[model samples]
Target: MSLKAQLQDEQKAAMRAKDKQRLGTLRMLMAAVKQREVDERIELDDEQVLAIIVKQVKQRKDAAEQFIAAERQDLADVELAEITVLEEFLPKPLSEEEISELISAAISQSGAAGMQDMGKVMGVLKPQVQGRADMGAISAAVRKQLA
Candidate 1:
């Protein structure tokens, strides 16, 4: 099933199970997806939906970090819970070894000999790693390889 359909099914299940937290999180995600579709005037494919989920997870992580720094454990916990729910829709994460290999391959494919070609390397890596790896980490790995 498409990711969006899977999300809808999960949302229905959450509703039937009376899983308030899960239901709320799914609703929030659906709203974000709908908002993006309306804004862009195009139906989002699975990759686009995954991108949205990834962005939401990143936002929640940043919020959780800020909440922790502010000593708001309750808020941070909520953010963390939301992150857990969002991550259910993401692909399995790549291992560090796998990510390193991907970076090496991307660099070679792009002929990225130096930091100046970081964009080329990232362009080659992003589609393959999206939703499966953290882009920031991937960029850092690419940077290290280039350097």
Candidate 2:
């Protein structure tokens, strides 16, 4: 089944199980997905949905950080919980060794000779790593390799 279908199934389960938090989070997710589809006037595929999910996860993390800094642990915990639910739908995170290998391959494929070619390498790496690895970590790896 597709990601959208999976989300629908989870939504039903959440409803049946009386999982208020899960249901609310899933509904918010569906809203975001539907919003994008409506705005763009096209149905989203798994890849597009994944992009939306990634964006939502990032927003949650940022909110959690802000909440923590403000000494509101309760709000921060909620954001963290939402992140856990959102991540369940994402692909398995890439291990360090796998990321390193991909970076090396990207660098070589892009013929990146130094820092000047960082963009080219990153351009090649982004699509392969999207939703799988943190772009910040990937950038650091690419920088280290170039150095």
lDDT of 1 by residue, 68-103 (tens): 999999999999999999998999999999999999
lDDT of 2 by residue, 1-147 (tens): 999999999999999999999999999999999999999999999989998899999999999999999999999999999999999999999999999999999989999999999999999998898899889989999999999
lDDT score at residue 32, model 2, on the 0-100 scale: 99
**lDDT of the candidates, in the order given:** 0.95, 0.95
Q: TM per model? A: 0.97, 0.95
Tell me the lDDT of model 2 at 139: 96
List candidate 1 segments past 4 Å from native. none
* Predicted structure 1, TM vs. truth: 0.97
User: Clash pairs of candidate 1?
Assistant: none
Clashing residue pairs for model 2:
none
